[model samples]
Target: MITVSAPPPPPPPQPQPPAGHAAAPEPARGRRWPTVVTSLVLLALLMFAQSFRFPNDSAVTEPMVASGDASAAVDAGSFTVKVDEVRFAKAIGDGAEDSGLSDFAPETEYIEANGVWVVVFMEVTATEKQLTTFESRLDSGDENVYASTSWLYNTFGSVDDGFPPGIPIKGAAAFEVPEKALKDPVVQMTISSGPGQRLAGEAHVKLGLSGDELKKAIDGAEETLDVPAPEMQKV
Candidate 1:
């Protein structure tokens, strides 16, 4: 009949961890799945980003171009040219026997065009040096490029020799091109020699030809275009 025996001695007190030792970690399962999923998501995002490619400046190698309309001056750093006039012809000749440079008579050298011959007269002046070389081309509306014919060499003012410093030199070049070229014709002039025009400054002039105007010029083109010898301009 004494009061109920005192509750069993208090359960033994739990022991404290030794100094500096960590308590046990939580079960790994709880954190493992979330960590793995986060890692996988990051990896997937990285892979997805790698799938696309972008364009940069390295892909462009075209020359720097100065563009203008016919009769306008287009300067290309190295030199400048003005499209003074444009003419069309079916055939062209020098009409002279002696060019002084050679005994070669250009009078008998009449060249017939497969399509139509376009003649361009330009006033050129060198900005960088008195010496410069030029190669000409036609960038046509039909996406065709026609190079200037060498047959006109010496017959017309030859820029082949280049222009003097400061003073403008008169010259002309001929290109045999399809009628479609006139639809949106552009004359491209490149400085020739050395590495050959790549990455260099180039001149482009829109000839202002298309539709009826183009047709009229083509239809009325001369049968045989003859011109006097090209002369150098005086300062």
Candidate 2:
């Protein structure tokens, strides 16, 4: 009998994809745009941090006696009497909102000297025109007596009652310095008839400082507050 028929021809080998056709591409390294951008950003931030620097504040000049005729008066020995530049500028606080320029014409403030506190107010023309005119009339004359409409002496008693009537005004009556407040240095002056009111007229005042020294302080303040005198209606 014949041997078993030969096994069927071997099945053809299965087809395989070409070497470069199907294998997953190797993961691209250092080619990521996002990663590169992120690295650059970090470097930039580091450089920026290194460049920053802080500023330092300068020292303040000490108070000095302003040179002038010792006997000069600022406002008839009432509001101001002397010129002490160092003291005048220092009267303004660091946090004060006003540039204090307006103070040159129709403004007032409180100050201290020789352990005394005083309020200072200058009554210039209350109107805008008067305010402008005042800027033109400031100067350093010894006998010049600029007439202030009214001036009041602030006292320690007023500190308690907030300035009662009977305070002296040169044009109206002889106002006396209360014995109780002889040593107190602060005084108040203003343009309004009352405290915290809009200025109705040109006026100014000084408090606390006193004597020849007080006069000198006001004169110094005048240098800072040299605005033209505002025109006043004739009586």
Per-model TM-score, in order, reads: 0.65, 0.18
Task: Estimate the overall C-alpha local distance difference test score of candidate 1.
Answer: 0.74
lDDT of 2 by residue, 95-122 (tens): 2224566555344442322322122322
**Residue 39 in model 2: shift from native, Å?**
27
Expressed as tens digits, the lDDT of each residue in 1-235 for candidate 1 is 6787777898788896666455444455666889999999999999898866435553254567889987678988877888988889998876563448556542356788898989888887777665556777888777788888777655332434755668877767788987765677898887643445555568999989888888998999988876445556787
Model 1 RMSD in angstroms: 11.4
Query: Which candidate leads in TM-score?
Result: 1
Q: Name the lDDT value of residue 133 in candidate 1.
A: 61
List clash counts for every candidate, in order: 0, 36
lDDT leader = 1
Worst window of 10 by summed lDDT in candidate 1? 153-162
RMSD of 2: 19.9
Local distance difference test, each candidate: 0.74, 0.30
